[model samples]
Target: MNSANLNIRTDKDVKEQAEQIFAELGLNMTIAINLFLRTAIRKRGIPFDLLLDAPNETTIAAMEEGKRLLNDPAAPKFSDMEDLKAALDS
Candidate 1:
């Protein structure tokens, strides 16, 4: 069987990070890429789950609210468990 060259363009940092991870997993870049391709072929799609890792709208709003409360001088603060429980029960 004959092998052909496959060239891919990627960011330098991305390549370096991938190389480091592959090295830790006992694979070179070439072998790691080949494994990915083979798995894709066998699975009829990409071998891993693709996800959007950014915070959702609700999470973003909650984070913003938390930041606002953290900066507000009038925000409630609990010094101990009893104080926290009393505040919650009110």
Candidate 2:
């Protein structure tokens, strides 16, 4: 396959940081970029699947609070949609 050179300008600090990391793994910037581009082309998108981790502390705390409210034994239970709507409308 014929390959052409690609040049791009990026943030110096970010590039330096990435360079350091890749260097540690024995990859230079050019090789890393070529590998990434090849992978993306082969996959027809970004090479890796992205997985979202659970949200940060505030979000987790709010979710826990919601769970506690939903599971509270003393909390009034809604028997049906009408009851739930009535509870919400009050």
What's the residue-level lDDT of 71 in candidate 1?
92
Per-residue alpha-carbon lDDT of candidate 1 for residues 1-90, written as tens digits (9 for 90 to 100): 689999999999999999999999999999999999999999999899998899999999999999999899999877899998998999
- Candidate 2: list runs displaced more than 4 Å: 50-58, 61-90
- Predicted model with the maximum lDDT: 1
Clashing pairs in 2: none
Residues forming the 10-long window of minimal summed lDDT in candidate 1:
70-79
Q: CA lDDT, every prediction?
A: 0.95, 0.93
lDDT of 2 by residue, 1-90 (tens): 787888899999999999999999999999999999989999999999888886999999999988998899987887899998988999
